[model samples]
Target: MPYSITVNGAVREVDVDPDTPLLWVIRDNLGLTGTKFGCGVAQCGACTVHVDGQPRRSCALPVSRLGNRQVTTIEGADGPEAKAVQAAWAARDVPQCGYCQSGQVMSAIALLREVKKPDDKAIDLAMNGNICRCATYVRIRAAIHDAAKALEA
Candidate 1:
């Protein structure tokens, strides 16, 4: 099947199986490698992306379901929330292995957009499945708080 989906503010037409995961479409077809492939299963938040402004596991999300909705990858993430999240991640030194940070950032941005000033519990809840092998939980929490504060300013 050929599906036309908007990605990174651009329209992408891809021909693949109906059940093809959006992760492969984004990485292999679109050449957006920022969204890494982690546990293949959705248990890991490695292939996270914003589908219509909501963070979703691209590894499991089928491309066929994305009818005309905007898919924002790490490459296309923009606006204040995205900027603050990125800056806070860098300032807080969130990534150690640098594999899961994109997913972390995407999840963080989504949380910030909704909660604005997410607390520890909220941060933990929002970032639950994003497994960072480097054990950067402390820094990830700190960066979320930092991004919330930055968004406030």
Candidate 2:
């Protein structure tokens, strides 16, 4: 079946099974590979993407369920929040292996978009499932804070 989905502000059509996960559709069908696949079961946030401005686990989200929702991947992420988050991540050296950073960044963007100045508890709650094997939680937290400050400035 062919479904029309808006990704990164563009309406894209892809022919795939209705049950196919959005992650594969984005990566294989659409060729947007920035959204990584860590845990296919959705336990890890590596496959996170913004579905209608809310962070969602793409791996578990079927393409049929996407409908007309706007999907934003790491490749499509932009704006002041994205710019600040990217700058903070780079400045703080947040990524170790970098496999999970895309999801981490995506989650961070959503958090910052909702909460301008998220404290430690809020950050922890928002980023709880985003696992960094290198254990860069401290740096991730710092980068989120820095990004928030940058947005303020």
Computed on alpha carbons, the lDDT of every model, listed in order, comes to 0.93, 0.95
How much is 104 displaced in model 2, in angstroms?
0.2
lDDT of 2 by residue, 127-148 (tens): 9899899999999999999999
What's the CA error at residue 87 for candidate 1, in Å?
0.9
Q: List residue ranges in candidate 1 displaced over 4 A.
A: none
Output the number of the TM-score-best candidate.
2
In terms of lDDT, the poorest run of 10 residues in model 1 is 61-70
lDDT of 1 at 33: 95
Q: How do all models score by TM-score?
A: 0.98, 0.99
Please report, as a residue range, the 10-residue window in candidate 2 with the lowest summed lDDT. Answer: 61-70
Clashes of 2: 0
